[model samples]
Structure formats: C-alpha cells, structure tokens
Target chain A: MQQTLEQKPPVSPKVSAPPMAPTFSIPEPAQMPVSADYKTVGVPLVENAKFAMRDVNVFYGEKQAVFNVNLDIGENEVIAMIGPSGCGKSTFLRCLNRMNDTIDICRVTGSIQLDGEEIYASKMDVVPLRARVGMVFQKPNPFPKSIYENVAYGPKIHGLASRRVDLDEIVETSLRRAGLWEEVKDRLDAPGTGLSGGQQQRLCIARTIAVSPEVILMDEPCSALDPIATAKIEELIAELSQNYTIAIVTHSMQQAARVSHRTAYFHLGKLIEVNDTQKVFTTPDHALTEAYITGRFG
Target chain B: MESSVLLPVLALLCALAFVAGRSRSLAVAGVGGMRILNSLPFYYGSLTAFWCALPSLAVVLIWSIFDGVIIENMVHALVPPAAVEAAGGNIGLVMNQVRNLAAGHLSADSVEPAIAAAADRLVALERINRWALTGVALSFALIGAILAWLKINPQLRARAKVEDIFRWTLLACASLAILTTIGIVMSVLFESMRFFSKVPVTEFLFGLEWSPQTAIRADQQGSSGSFGAVPLFAGTLLIAGIALLVAVPTGLMVAIYLTEYASPRMRNLIKPVLEILAGIPTVVYGFFAALTVAPVIRDMGVNLGLDEWLTISSESALAAGLVMGVMIIPFVSSLSDDVITAVPRSLKDGALGLGSTRSEVVKLVVIPAALPGIVGSVLLAASRAIGETMIVVMAAGLAANLTANPFDSVTTVTVQIVTLLVGDQEFESAKTLAAFALGLVLFVVTLGLNYFALYIVRKYREQYE
Candidate 1:
C-alpha cells in the first residue's frame, strides 16, 4: 500500500486512498483507481514541445468525451495515443489542429498551443494552422484524382507552386519521401484511389507532406491495412520521425511499441499514463496502465 | 355466367383445394410428422392452390377471347353468300350491323329477312357459348384440384414445384408490361408509316417548312401540307437548351450549398420547399409562364430597348424556358443533391485535413468525385425539359419558324403534336397522323437521354464501390 502511494503522483484525489480491484471480474466505478480530478501521470511535459495541451475538456453535445488532460508533443518526436474505443484519444489528437471544429456539436474547452501559438484562439485561422499541421486518417482516403494531382492538391491550394514544373517536382519529391515514387512513377496519370490500400495511404501521406508541414497527426494510419502494409507504414513513420513531429492514435499496442518513442494511455475520458514507450510496456507507473497493457481490460 | 362471377367461384375452389392438400400431406407424413416430409404443409397448400386456379383461369381466358369470333362465324353461316357479297364480303361491317340488330338497337324492319334471321342466330349462339364455357371451366378447375390432391405425398417436391410456378408468374407479369409498351409503339409506328406514305420520310425529317394545313374538301382552297419537322425539332432543342442553362447552375449551387454549407434545420426546411416546387403542376407553371413571366420578359426587353438586336414577342422562348427551368430545379437539385451528399465522408475529410477550405474541398474533391453522377442528373433533367408539353403549349406559340433566335415564336414537337390533335380533323389526314410520327421521334430522343443518364450513374457507382 505504501508502494502504491509512491506509485501515484501528488495530484491523486483526497476523497480516499487509491482504489484497488480483484483479479478477474469487472468492477464498479468506485473500484477504479483513476479519479475525476486526476492529472495525467508520467511525463506529460517536455522542454522542446512542438504542440502542447493544458486542462483540455471535450464534449459531444451533453456527453463529456475527454476529461481534463495535459500533454505535450516534443519536436520531431513520435507519440502514440493508445486507448479503448470511445476513449477520446482521437478527439484529443484532433484538438492539436482544431480538426474538431468541423464537427457541429462537438465543443472543446482547452488551451492547445502549437509552437507557443494558441491554435484554439478565436483569431487564429484554421487554414494556415492546418497547413502547418497535416493529418492522415485511419482509412486511406486518396482524393479522386490522378496520382499527380493527388500529390499536387496541397501545394496548389496553398499556392506553394508557381509553375507546373514546380508542382511536378514537389509531387515527385513528396512521393519519394513517402517511398511511393518508384512503384507509381510509371502511372502518374492513373487515379490515386485505384492504387493498393498501402499505396493509397502512402499517397495520402505524400499529399500531406507536399505542403511541407511541421507536424503530422495520424489517427490509426495502418488500421485498415494488411500486416505487410502496416509494417511498411511503421518503417515510414520511423524514417519520418527524423524530420517531422508526429502524434499518432493507434489501437495496436505493439504498433505503438514498434514506432512511437512515447506512448500515452487514456481510459474513461481521463489520461491514465504517458511515459517512454519501453517503460510503459515494461513497468508502467499506474496500475490501470499495467492492467490495460497486460490485456486485462482496454 | 359472367367471367367475373366465374373468377370468384374458381377462387373458392382454390381455397378448398388448399385445405384438402394440407390435410392429405399431413396424412402422408403419418406418425413421423413433418420431419420426414420433403416440404412443409404450407408448400403443399400453396402448390395445390396454384394448380386449382392457374389452369382453369388460362382455359377460361382463352375460351372467352375466341368464343366471340367462333359465334360470329356461326352467324356468318346463317347469312347467304349473295348478301355477304352485296356487302362487299366485309365480315366486320356485317357483324356490327348484326350485333346492333340483336341488341334491338336497330329495327328489324330496316334489315332484310336474311340479316334479321342471322341476328336471331347470333343471340342464340351467344347464350349457348356462355353455358358451355362455365361447364368446361368448372370441370377443369375440379379436375386440377383432384390431381393436385392425389399428387401430394411425403416424397413429393412440393416446395420446388411451388417456387417454379411463382417464378413463372412473376416472369409473365413482367412480360405483359413490356409487351404492352411494344404494342403501343407498334400502333404508333404503323400510323407514322401511313403518314410517311402521304409525305416523304426525308421531307418530314429534314424539311424546314412545316405548314401542315391541307384542304378539308376536294375543291377547298388551302396550302398543301408540308410536314417538315426540322423547325419543330430546332424549337425543342432551343427551349430545352435554355432550360438546361437556367436550371443546371442554379440547381447545382443549391445542391452544393445544401450538402456543404446548410445547417440541419436549414436543410430540412429548404429541401422540402424545393420538392414542393417540383410537385407544383407544370400546368400551374404554364399559367405563371403565360400570364406573368412572358409579359415581364417582354416588358423588360422593351425597357432595355433590346429591339435593336432582336424583337421580343410576348410568347418568347426565354419565358417558357425560364419557367420550365424553375419547374425542373427540384429535379436537378434533388438528384444532384443525392449524389453530392453521397460523396464519401472520407474524401471530404482528407481534403479538409490538408488545410483546404470547405469551398476548395468541394471544388477539388467532392465535385470531381460526384461529377459523373451530376452529369447524369443533368442529362435526366434535360430529358424532362424536352418532354415537357403543357408549358410550351400554353406559352410557346405554334409557329414552326426554323430560326435560332429565342425571342421569335417557335413550336416544339410536343406542342405541335398537341395542336395537331386538339381540334376537328379526320384521323386519315397526314396532318392528324403527323402527331404520331412526332410522338415516335420524341419517344426515341427521351429514351436515349434516359439510357445515357443510367449508364453514367452506373459508372459513377462503380468508381466508389
């Protein structure tokens, strides 16, 4: 019990000692260790932060989806958010670029800053902000255009390419970085959607990078892909970590371990733990995190 | 007995057959119950029901159809060859007069003794035919029911047999609908052929002058009718083109605004309002076109002093086209809106995630994705505009002027067809039969347009799936 006390941070609730549960059967809310007022455990802060969130709360209509949470994405770092379905990990990821603004009834109350600039400010425009923070989704959604146009979509919209030659070069370079230029070079005029699933996702990634973004937020980028396709994406993610900051929300714990440097685990709208990937998988600080990692419960 | 009454009696026998077949199948199954039976009792019941009804219905229908001709042949036998030859051996003419006499619609004094004697024979033969028909049909129904009852055993493949009958019944109904369409088309084709016999096909197809006014009597003075349909075709294309011009942009904008911009409350309020525009009778639009829009356009043209370029008639094509465009806005909006809304969410989000604005996403991703379906919708709308008759009839005047100008009075094929059939004219005239020829052309054009729309829509569906 003393060791358990040491396990918890100072922000643990004052109502009672940390709650404990038996080995097998599902428990009541009271037996759950995490409190409503819980502050995120482990290293949720960093010095070289590219994106940071503080006291964030998200609601879909009357239902609170994400409770108060604080976390930071370091510069050029890969952080994977792992959680059960409807745990608000995706919602939390969307706050970085204010992507949730598109959802009509979803309301977010928090201070989300990118490069010390508050992204959720009323004055900030999402177009430029999103141009800086590109996103890849769970499904490989390539635009219904030829491969050349699909990669050129971002640069054209942003006016980054003054000439057709410039656009072509950007397309080739972006696809090269995404590791897709070799296979698709012969068929640049072919429809982007006609490509294989893995290729399509990589095309989306190339399209994202063509605008030269500072950060890439991916929501389960490899979930729809086959195992080989997923491994290729993991490798791409590893290579991409050298140049761009990435915040990925993934269902696969092993994927988080394989690609991300730091992993954040959320449960029931609260952040239970965020730590170095190896520490989280080997010796998690929070008992709830251990319970989740060992497959006791999501 | 009336065949309508016979139908009910046969239906009652079918019900009895259903019960008998069910019980017999149960008896066949014995202590083993339904487990050992090839099919359930339900299948046996329906199988017997169909057997009892179908064969008897077929026989009764065929008998009723041919009995009139058979009895008429018997009546013809009653009349001597001399009387038939005097009537030019016209069996139909003699039959009509004989039928009128039998019904007492014509006096016996007006006809010769041979004709009167034949009319009496017609009445007797008809009475005998009815009794014989009822006897044969009822016996067939009873025999069918008994045969079906005897065939119902545990080993019988009652389910499969019943299913086969159902499939054939559905196929029969489908064929009937298609056959009726073909029959109507054939009648039109034959009449058009008669019209072509009077006027050359090339002249009707490519001639610009369309003065279809022919002399009423042999000595009467009138213009020799020239059935040049080009002027009518040009007017249709012009008006339909103008309508498309007005409808396509406005309707596409409405669709985009609804799908990409409108709030749920606004969408709900606006969509039904647009549909109400569609539901408003084209006749009502005709009234609006003729009374309101046409005069307004003429006055506006006068105010603008546009007479320097072209004259503006009260029945200008612009007015009809504009009002027609309004009438079709709901169609364009409804159909295109369905496709636009069906633009996959992932595609929209992908563009959005790339930092593109809503309008940019719509322009670059959503619209391009849905373009084939949108073009299909526009084609469908064009077909409707081309086929629209009431507005053109009321607003567009019946002047077959082969001019490209919209301000001049011009007439469409639909309007010409309407005018040709509206008043006192004999069906034998090329002028009257010209309506059927025009109808055939319009049918082919609309059929082509509809087929193209379906093909494009199917192509768009394949892209997404």
Candidate 2:
C-alpha cells in the first residue's frame, strides 16, 4: 500500500490526508440529522463584481427549484458552484445569462445585475446581453456545421467581423484560445459533430469566445469526458480565467478546488458556504460542505 | 360427418386435452410438491392444446383445399369425352352449368342428358369427399390428443416447447407481410411483361403520345391505342411539383410556429385541427377540388378576363394540385413538428445564451440540426402527392397532356391507370395491360424517391447525446 501511494501522482497535498484518516469518525446515516439549514448569504459581496445577484429565486411552474441565493462573480475570477445532483447549482449558473428564459415554465424573481445594470429591466434586450455572457452546456452541443462555421457563428451573427478574412481570424484566434487550433486547423471544413467529445466541447468553448464575451458560464463542461479529456479542459479553464470571468457548475469538489478561485457550496437549493477554494476544501465553514467534500453523502 | 361438425369436435378434443394435461401435471407434482414441476401449470395446458390442435387443423385444411378440385375432376371424367370435346376447352362454363343443376337452381329440362348424369355424379363425389375429409380429420385429432396426453409428464419441458412454437408462429406472421409484398411485385411484373410483349418497351417508355384508347370492335373508327406513357409521367411530375411548391413552405412554417412560438394550449388545439385535414377522405378532397376549388379558380380566371387567350378549364391541374397540397399539409407539418421538437433543448439554449434571438436560434441551430428529418418529411409529402389519384381524377381531367402549365387540363399516372382499367375492358388487350405498366413505373419512381430521402437523412443525420 505504501509503494502504491508513492507510485501514484498526487492531485493535491491537502486532499490526500482526509481519505487516509480513519473512516470511523464519519457519522452514520441513521445518526445524522435529517436536514440542516443553509446560510442564505454566503460571502455574497465582492469588491470588483462583474455580476451581482442579490436574493435570487427560481421556480419551475409551481415548484421552487432554487431558494433565495445571493452571490457575486468577480471580474476575471473563476467561481465554481459545487453541489449534489439537482441542488439548483446549474439553475443558479443559468441565471447569470438568463438562459432559463428559454424554458417556458421557468420563472425568475430577483435582481441580477451585470456591470451594475439590471438585466431583467423592461427594455433590456436579451440579444446583446447574451452576446456579453456566453455559455457552454454539460453535454457538448456544437451546431451541426463545419468547425470553422461553428466558431464563426457567433461573430457572424453579432456582426463582430465585417469581412471574410476578419471572420477567419476570429475563428482561428478563438480556437487557438480554446487550445483546439493545431488539431483542427487543417480540417476546418469537417462537421463539428464528427469530432471527439473533448474536441467538441472545446469547439463549443471556442464558439462562445468568438464573440469575445465578458463572462462565460459553463455547466459541467467536462463531466461527459474521459479523464485525459477532463484534464485538458481543466487546463483550458485555468488559462481562460485570465481573460474572461468564468462561473462553472460542477459535481467534482476536487475540480472546484483545483480550478476556481472562489468555491460556493449548495445543498437542497440553498447556499451553504462560500470561501476561497483551499480554505473551503481544507476547513469548510459549514458541516454540510465538509460532509459533501469528504464524500459522506453526495 | 360434415366439416362444420368435424371442426367443433376437434376443438372439443383440444379443450379436453388441456384439462387432462393440467390435472396430470398437478397429480405428478403431488408426488413431491408443486415446485417439482419444471414449468407453470398453465404452460403445460397450452402446450397440450397446441399439440392436439395443430396437426389436426393442418389435416382439415389440406383436405378442404383438395376436395373441390378432386370432385370437379371426377365429374369431368363422368361427362363423355366427345361431349367434353364439343365444349372446345370451355370446361369452366360447363362446370358452372353442372353446378347450377346439381344445386337445383337450374331446371332439369334445359340440360343435355350427359350433363344431367354428370351433375348427379358431381353430387355423389362431393358427399363422398366430405365424408372422407371428416373421417381423416377426426382420426388425426384423436391420435394427436391421445399422444399429447400420454406425453404430458414432469420432465416434458412443456414451457420450452411452447415457447419454441410461439417463436416460430411470430416468425410466420412477420414473413406473411414480406411474402405478400413479394407476391404483388411478381404479379405486376408478369403483367407488365405481357404488356411489353404487345407494345415495344422503348415506345412505351420514351414515346410522348399517351392515347390508350384501343377500339373495342375492329370496325370502330380511329384510336389504334398508342401505348406511349411519357405524357402521363410528365403530368404526374407537373401536378406533384405544384403540390410540393405549395406544401413545403407552408408546412415548414406551420411546424416552426407550432414547435417554437405557439403556447402549449394553442399548439394542443391547433395541431389536431390541422391533422383533421389528413383524416378527410381523398374522395372528399376530390369533391372539394371538383365542386369548390375548380369553380373558384375558373371564376377568378374569368374575372381576370384571360379566358379569350387561354381557357382555364374547370378541371385545371392547379386546382387538383392545390387541393392535394392542402390534403398533405398534415403529413409534412406533423412529421416536421416532431423532428423540430426532437432538436435538443440544450442546443437551443446554447444558441440563446450567445445572444441569438428566438428566430436566429431556430434558423442557425434548431433547423440545421433538424434538417435531415425536415427533408425526409418533404420527400414523403412529395411521394404522397405523386401517388394522389382521386383529386387529380375529378379536378384535373384524365387528358394526359405532356405540358407543364398548371392551368391546363392534365392527368397523373394514377388517374390514367384508373381510366384505363375501369368499366368493361378485355384483359388480353394492350389497353388493359398498359395499366400494369403504368403502375410499375409509378412504383419505381416513388421507390426511388423514398430511397433518395433515406440516403440524404442517413448522410447528414446529426446524432446528439
């Protein structure tokens, strides 16, 4: 066992100790409390906020999906939302770009501001708002077009490129930024769907960045990929956070700790804790966050 | 015994075998317990019923099929050779007369002596045949029931045997549809070959004239019945082209509206009402085309005062094409609607998240993703339009003109087929056989269209996770 531990490359120096500790200290399911209240406002305010969401609530028809949640996404910083499945993390992430408006039954009641301007204002058109805030889905959804066309789709639609050469440059630069240019530059005419899952996801990221959005929202972008592919995307995310504000929803606590600057923990549609990634993973302020990160129950 | 009684007696034995087998299993199980039985009791009962019923039913079927032919041959043998020779190989007519006399529907005074004697023999032969069938069928049923009852034991593997039989029965049912399709193709091919023997294949395919009016009497003037089918093919294309032009845009727009824009309540209400257009019988559409649309078009043409230069016949190709388009709207809209709805919500969200408006999302993402299915729907509508007959028959008169103009009278392949085959026409004439030729060509065209549609759909299908 000692030889095996030395043979494996470490993910992090801090995360290795918790699993090595005795398992008996973990609480039994029967003895644990049935429910725990969450903090409603977990470190909500940031000094250089790119997006400030205060008291957000989301509903799907008669069912409330996300309870009141207040959070701030800082400029050029990666904020990762981590939770169990169906904990409303993805719903909260969608609120950043108002993507939930596409769903007929979904209703939002809160003030979501981008650059101190209210997004839900009566006259605010969603077109330019969405151009400013792009998204990547959990499963890669590239348009059924050529790789070049997929990357150029956004810039073409928003008229970001005035000429064919300009469109070509934007496509090349976006794919390069997403770390897919060298592999796909020769076959730009190939359909986007023909690429591997990892490449397809990168193509989606490239498409989002073609319009040069100020904020990029990603929902489990690497959950559908292999481990090698996941590492590549994680690397891409680390590089991308330098130029754009990123908010990602993930089930992997380790991924949050590795990639994001600020990590937010959600449980049962409520925000439980928000802090720096290392601080939250090493010494969580809330018991629920600790239980989740330690793999007690989802 | 009569066959009607024989059938019921065999069924009764089968039922008895079922009860006997079930009780026998229970009794055998009693030696240990119910768990000792290899299968459930019901399977054993059904297995016994099948064993008893199947062989006996086969015997009955074979006997019934052969009985009529064997009796007819014996009756033919009874008729004196010279008298049968005098009938000039028209034995079928002679059999009909003899059958009428034996049934006592014909007066005895009208028939010849040889025929009357043969009729008596026919009656005797039929009775003997029935008696023989009854004896053989009953004996088979008895043997089967006794054997199956004796075979029923704990180690019989009755469930496995029954399941094997069930599998074979399902295979048999599935092959029945394939076999029927093959049978139709072969019959049409033979008839078409017969037609080609009379009219040269090149002329039938390439010749432009399509006047298929062969004189019934040799003395009748004009109409030597040209077998050229180019005009019919042209007419079919013209009418179908007009129909596709009308249907494609309208159907696609309606689909987009229903799937993308309409409220759920509005969609639920409008979708079925549109589909009701499909449920309206083709004959009803024909009547609507003939009585309403054709007259309206004519009135409009007259009001425009273009009647002097070009007469818009009440039965214009435009009228039938328009009505057929309306008829197939549900076909296109329903299929396209389903495909559009199937485009993943995530793709639409991805586009909307890029600041694309609803219409932009539809055009760039949803429609392109759904393109293969949308094209498939259009091809299906085109096939339906090409094969449409009743509306074309009533509204577009059966005058196979080789012209592309929509306002002129025209006829489709199906309409010409109907007119050529209807009423009193001799089967041996080239005119009647030409119908089969036209049908073969129509089938080929539609088959080619379907294949092309499938090829396009397969080549470009976008598989989403």
Candidate 3:
C-alpha cells in the first residue's frame, strides 16, 4: 500500500507555464498530505448542503444562456461564483431560486434541489419559494415606498409576524443582520428611494432577510457601490455566512477570494472548476481555470 | 374713374421710388454692398414699402370711418329741424330709403321732397369725400416716398430701423390677441353687470326657480319669468356628471388597455379607430343622439314599466350626455395613454423584478405614478363636456328642469345662450344680456378646472424628480 501511494500520478500539473519554457518534473501525489480531515474538506457549520445544482442548463428563447453546470452550496457557508461578463455566472445564480421565471423568454432546466427537495416542480408555489430563497439584485430595487415599509414588504406579504410588535422586532432584527439599523433608525417614514445606493442595497438585503429566508442569493450586490460600501457588504457577507447559506455572483475575482470559503470558476456558461478558495486561487486542476486564475484569459 | 387713375399713378410712383432708393445704395457700393449691410435686402425693400403704404393706409382707414358721419351730419343740417323732429329719429331709415330710390331701386312709395333733396345732397357729399380722401392718400404716399428715399443713405442703417419697426409691429400683433380676449371679458362683465342690476345678484345666484320670461304686454297678467339661474346650472351639472360617469371609466380602461396590455399592432389599429370618434363633428353626434339614441332610451324606459313622467323624452339629457361622453372619449383616452406610455420602462421592470404579478404592478405602481397626468386628461374632458353646445342643443330639451334624473328633458347654459340670441332680437334686452352672464360663468368654471389640473400635474412631477 505504501508503494502504490508513492507511485500515484499528480492530479494537476502547472499549465500556466509558457509553451517554450523548460519542462519541470511533475511532483508525485505521495509528497502531498493524505490526512483524512484536510482543510480543503473542512466541514461547514451546517451539516446539510442547502442547494445542489446538477448539470443545470438555461436558455433564453433560441440562445443558450447557461450550459451544463454543477455546484453545491453548503449550509452556513459563503460560496462565490465569479466569471467574466456574459460567462453565465448570474444566469447560474438566478437558477438557484427560480428567479429567472420572471423573464418570459427564459427557460431553465436540469435538477436544482433545495434541502434535497426539487425546487422547479410544477406544483410548487413560486412566491413562497422566492420567500425561502431571497435575492438581492445587481442594482438596489427598494420598493418606491417608505423605508420602514420597504423593510416590511416581504414580511407583510409572507405573514411572517402576527402582531405589530413582532413585526417591528422582525424588521429591527433583519435590519440589524443587514447592518443598516443604526443609520436608518430615525427616518423610517421617509421614501426608500431617497437613500444612497449603498444604503438602498442594504435596505434591499434587510427586506429580503425580513422574511427569514433559508438562503440569500446576491448578484453583484456591490457593483453599484463605493469601495467603503463594498467593504462593509463584504464584511456583512462574511458574518452572514455563519447563519445563512450565501451564494454571491461577482465579476471581481478578488472579491470572491476575499469573501467566500469556496469559489466556483465559470467560463462560457460552464463550471470550469470549483474547490477550496485558497486552493482554487493558488492551484487549479483545469487549464482554463489556471489561465483564468493567472489572468492569462477570461 | 379719374380718381382711380390718379391713385394707381401715385402708387406706381411710390413703388418706383422704393426700387430706385434700394438700387442706388447697392450701386454706390458695388455687388457686395448688400452682404456688407447689417440686414438683408428684403428689410430695406420692406422698409421702403412700409413707409410708402403705412401713412396712406392710415389716412384711408380714418377717412372712411368719419366720412359717412360727416356727410350724414351735413345732410341733417340741411334738412329743417322741424322735419327732423317729426321723423321721430327715423331720419336715418328715411335717408337709407331715399338713397335706395336714387340708386334706381324703387321704394314702396314716394318720399317727401325734403328727404329726396337731402339724399341727392348726400350722394354729392359722398363723392366729394371720396375725392378728398384720394387726394390726401396720394399726397401722403408722395411724402412717405420722398422721406424714405432721403433716409436711404448707407449711414442710415435701414435694417436696424426696419427691424425696430418690425419688432413693434409683432408686439402690436401679439397684444391684439390679448386685447381681444380682454375686450370679450369686459363685454361679458358689463352685460352681466347689467343683468345683475335688473335681477338682484343673490336671486340670480341662489334662487331655486329659473324662469326668465317677463310679460310682453301690460294686458297679459301673471307672466313673470323667473331669472333664477339655479335650474339651468343644475341641468348643466346633471348632464356633465352623467357624461363624466360614462367617459372616465371607459376612457381610462381604454387607455390602460392600449398602453399596458395591447400589442403594438393592436394599438396601432385600435387607436386610430377610437380617435375617429373625436373627429366626428359634434353636430353629427347631436343629430344621432336626437334622432336615434333618445328614442331608443325612451322605448327602453317604457318597456321597463316607467311612469309617464319618468319616461325618457325624445330630447332627454341622458341621450345628450351619453353622446357627449362618446365624443370626448378620444380626448381623454389618447392623452392619458400618451402619459401612461411616457412613464419610464425602468419603473415597470423594478416592480416586476420584485416578484409582483403584472396586474398588481399596474394597479399599485403604474397607476399611482401616472395619476396626475390622468387627472389632467379627465379635467380637460370635463371642460369639453361643459362647453359642448351642438349635442346639448339638439338632444337636450328646451325646458331647464332642475331634476337630477338623466331621463328627464333638461337644458344647459350653452343652449339657453344660443336660443337667447339666435334670431331677430333686440340686443339690449335682459334676455340677450343674460347670455353674457352665462358665458362668464362657463368661462370661470372651465378656467378653474384647467388651473387645478395643471397644478396637480406639476406637483406630482416635483415629487418624482
């Protein structure tokens, strides 16, 4: 058994080297640790994965938007999906909660199971499904209503609280979780649209969390925000992963590296590679993944 | 004939002077002289033309107005004062008859020799006045031409002078429209004041009865016509209310369907058809209401077992109001549709992306966003309903019943005003003067509605932007 382990071939060779460069000897798998509990397989705080997408495919009318893709969103863990523009990362994210159903021409297929139950079943109620899987859009889309009402909209629709006091508690808790309570505690009656972009995005997050969703899907939530706001949101995401499963779609690879425990690399609608964030950045299995990690190509 | 010949000669001379002055300036400084000038060549030509025509036209206009009065007064002076008194201020009528007779259209009977001799003198006076006017006009034209020619030096800056005059002319034209509006308002106010003096202002305003007849003869008894305007106003409101009740919902629904639901091809096809309803002449609608809709409504009421008094009339207010509503539907729908469509598409997307259903989005967001513009359209339609005359005139009854029942015959202020001044009538009577009072009230009401609508629209805009 020791001789067989010593003779095993390397799983990933460094493909980022130039074609004309001198060849280096491939390291044997024996040199790497074989511990049963590796850091790359560190268990998430929540035992069950929240969502498991298997070979998901999406089409927009005649054009294919997302090709066969597979990803796993572990419970109470942050997973970031990052890719170049038009790489179908956002499309893949929208498929998680069936948000793409709002688009008339969009058609999504392949099995996406939440907590081991199929989400796209014909009999399922999309509204309640959306409540369970809340989303924050690229641009902050607070209802053109009062700030308090914007935070209360989802709870009101879902009947999340029975009494006014309970509703207030839910609102306060959600705002607190979104880290927006203190800044907006005074002007709850003002219009939500009057807030800055970052505040509005946070307000949307508070609105989404108000319903006590099991998972939060964020699609470039900080793209329209300033650096300070982006930093705040990144820290919030890190904290949020302790309680809720978070799947963030971002164009910024550094943002993925900074915030996520696991990073999934997508290219041209395909999942090129997904592994532990540090390992995915420092070493990747696929040539496309290696090129993308080193900025050789998208 | 000789004066006509002289007038043309004088006009030709003026035209020649203008051409000569313009050419001389251009010739003095070669071909590029006009380009170097401050203004275009047309300005110089117009300046010369203006100088030539203005004084002459003013003289002619003034002379024409006063010449008739001067000649009539001269003729009256020649007639014996006793004869003028005996004619009982019928002298003007008699003079007209005598002049007709002199022109060889035979009068019914021979006039008195004094009147005939006066008429002949009047003709001679008119001829003399005409000759004097022609001479004055020619002399003025000549003076204007000479002055324009003398002022045509390059240093004179003919363009600037012309532009100055042109600017004043434009201002005067603009003021003409404003003055006309003011004059109309003043006339209405004056006559309304006279009516108020005859009938106390309080009685006219608040009296429940609205009869306006007075006994024509002393022998006739108990023929006092009530001047209370309450019945007419009530009739107007009742009809307009019915119109709005029918129009607002239908128009708004049509607008929503066109803007939100219908496909582009369907909208293009249906919008023109609806607009055709607006283009149909109100008189056509009037006849259709009077001839077709009223009878149908009457039969329907009878079939429904209505009492005779409650039965619809051949000229019921309902028919008029319904037709008027149809007439104004395009006005409301088209305007509202344009405003609704003008709402930014991003607003719709935002609502939809929130997972709200399409109907919910439209009901909760789109309509509220477009409420101000919709209100403006509705107010405009209301004003149109109030001001509509032909439909009310033909379909609505003449009696100004104060009842709110649309099936009953009723009259509006516009119809009453039309009847008051339609045929051979004395303009100074209280009946004729009442038309102005009604007109004033109508104008005030419509103006108030317009201003309120505009205010609502402006306020809504401030909130969003």
Q: Which candidate tops TM-score?
A: 1
Model 3, B216-268: lDDT tens per residue? 67678757767778888898888888888889999999999988888778999
Q: Which is superior by TM-score, 1 or 2?
A: 1
RMSD of each: 6.8, 9.8, 11.4
lDDT of 1 by residue, A154-246 (tens): 999999999989999999999999999999999998888899999999999999999999999999999999999999999999999999999
Q: List where candidate 3 sits over 4 angstroms from the true fold.
A: A1-144, A157-163, A170-180, A196-298, B1-83, B90-177, B306-314, B458-465
Model 2: CA > 4 A from native: A1-42, B85-89, B462-465
Tell me how candidate 2 scores on lDDT. 0.88
**Candidate 1 ranges beyond 4 A from true positions:** A1-33, B1-4, B80-91, B454-465
- How far residue B345's Cα lies from its native spot in candidate 2, in Å, is 1.9
Positional deviation of A5 in candidate 3, in angstroms?
70
Error of 2 at B75 (Å): 0.7
Residue B233 in model 2: lDDT? 87
| Fnat, 2 decimals, each candidate | 0.70, 0.72, 0.04
lDDT of each residue in B138-202, candidate 2, tens digit only: 77777877787787778889899999999999999999999998998888899999999999999
Between 1 and 3, whose DockQ is larger? 1
Rank candidates, TM-score, best first. 1, 2, 3
- For model 2 chain B, give the 10-residue run with minimal summed lDDT: B456-465
Q: Order of all candidates by DockQ, from best down to worst?
A: 1, 2, 3
